[model samples]
Target: MMYTEENKKEVILFGYGKFGRHMYHHLSQGGHHVKLATMVESNYEEASADRIKDIKRFNPKHNDSIRMLGINPAKHLLYCAMEHTSNNLFLVLSLRELYHDAMIVAISNSEENTRKLKYAGADTVIDIYEASAQHLVTNLTKPAVAEAISTIFFEKNNLKIAEILLESDTLLEGKHAAEIDFYGRGLILVAVIDREMGDELIYLSRGVDHKFDAGDTLVLAGKADDILSFKMELAGV
Candidate 1:
């Protein structure tokens, strides 16, 4: 997907480990401005030339070094996916302290660390193991649902998963999910993650008419171009 300057989001990724690398690949492929930051020297040598060019080395222990990156607290989306839980926790803490309003997403290895990361000021904490286990269980018990997700996310290269952030006074705010013509825009409303609902994903496939609100994340699935066009239209750009 090609994002115009008006709508492109800046993504700053800390660590170049498995999860970090995966995030970089997808975000870059989607045409977002992504910067990969790492403290380990070997990670630079291991990363590809394209990624290495954008990689910035910084000392994770120092607040000054992190601030040197010049991250825009209001605009840049930060991801802390260091291989070690302690590193991720420290990074999240430092980032929260530096940019109190910034959105920090961290990956945790266990439920215990998920709580720690959240307490450390991460806005979103993704438990990798828990997510994996859930996917495994879903595949085993809900084969049809699993197959459908796999087909949309993995099997179809043209399809993309988009997280549309709703802002105050936006066009869709206060509207019901059923009232929107998503299919006309060539998109599917997969789910809605509302902040008021403790960030729980309310799947639309259940036929629930969810009322839109600011801070709600609409998860949509569709062709990349169609998704981007619809996003621009929603933003009135």
Candidate 2:
């Protein structure tokens, strides 16, 4: 996918590493200026050109690069490269003084880095390892849950995980989410049923005491076994 000049917001990528190239092309094809920066442009060659296009290069080590190019407001979305997994907080924070309202997406190889990035004021800190691992697990084991889950790029491995339908004879039928603790027992309850207005996913523990209807479903999380056990318990299996 390539952007042929039709998008609105200009996007700037902080590095030309693998993640940078992926983010650049993904955003570019979706329509953005997609200025890709790196210590050198040679890293982004024809071999990887298919994944990137019209990338503006810069030197990562040059202070002038940060002064002139690293923090430009011309771009609306700035995706920091995550593949390098180095001191990205400093690089990302340096841009804040330059582009105040720019939407910054920081990618980290670990949860610690992700937390650091968030602490440093990145718009969103994405966990690259978490995203990759989840995708691998879901794709390899349960391809059925790919779309039901939110994009790993945005979520911290805890999005709308799994959806389940409840039967009338379930033990957890007339239960409230707050009554049961899913904080560490594995899995969290995101929504429950109202049983009337067509899939009205009411937030758990917010004071909706409606009993479980036959067609009602309870969405939950954790491992596949936990999810299934939750469903069976609710379905009276």
Candidate 3:
């Protein structure tokens, strides 16, 4: 049940707040089925209506309403984006109690809350303020990289930057980029992070003759399907 950056997950967003909606959009755009749930309080019909309104504000064409906790709890990425950090922590605790292998991601409001969320068994805890500040810094320092990130996160297309690790016996280990014909494969090899060289990511502006090594990570930017094909080729499958 170890989740890696390469693993695509079906998400169940556990709130209808601003951050929850934001996560929903990103997950859906990333080709994941996302479901919404909210804590039931007071009148069930009223709470469901409120959640539906929040969803429609983002997706006007969406007519489906958020449901309660009837979702199959296992094998899903559970996102706890409740506006209240304490409530999110409680939800994480409850989810962990039910689904031991579920990947729970939570958002935190403060540094203390981030620690608390992690302690409460959230696999990943993100602080909105800190993430926003980091995005601002990247935009300021590395505009080109920031633009690439924005294209992946903000754009609705399937274009994205993906990383693939080469195994010792991979077919792509010692082949040059031109030998593999990246242009024909519908992708561009962006960079190579050499493991022997302290894992420094070297951008390949001219990698026709660049030889890949075992354990070297390939950074590519292209359509998601093309990236999958490249990974499969690397594995000689």
For residues 1-237, what per-residue lDDT tens digits would candidate 1 score against the true structure?
334455568889998888888878877776788888888877766675544577788887999999888899888999998888988899999999989899999999898999999999998998998988988999999999998778776663677677888988878999998888999999988899988988689998787899999999999888888988887787888
Highest TM-score scorer: 1
Better of 1 and 2 by lDDT: 1
Off by over 4 Å in 3: 1-8, 40-74, 163-219, 223-225, 235-237
* Model 3 lDDT per residue over 41-116, tens place: 4222443664543221111112132223444556577888886787788777777666677788999988999999
**What residue pairs are clashing in model 2?**
39-60, 170-234
Q: Could you tell me every candidate's TM-score relative to the true structure?
A: 0.74, 0.52, 0.63
Write down the TM-score for model 1: 0.74
RMSD of 2: 12.7
Error of 1 at 120 (Å): 0.1
The lDDT, on a scale of 0 to 1, for candidate 3 is: 0.71
> Model 1: runs farther than 4 Å from truth?
1-8, 48-51, 154-156, 161-237
Ranking by lDDT: 1, 3, 2
For residues 1-237, could you state the per-residue lDDT of candidate 2 as single tens digits?
121233347767777667776776666556566676665446656325566554555554455766666455654577788356554666677666556777778988878888888877688887877988988898878876774554422343433256666666665556755566666557876787666767567876677655566667666656555665565666566
Report model 3's TM-score to 2 decimal places. 0.63
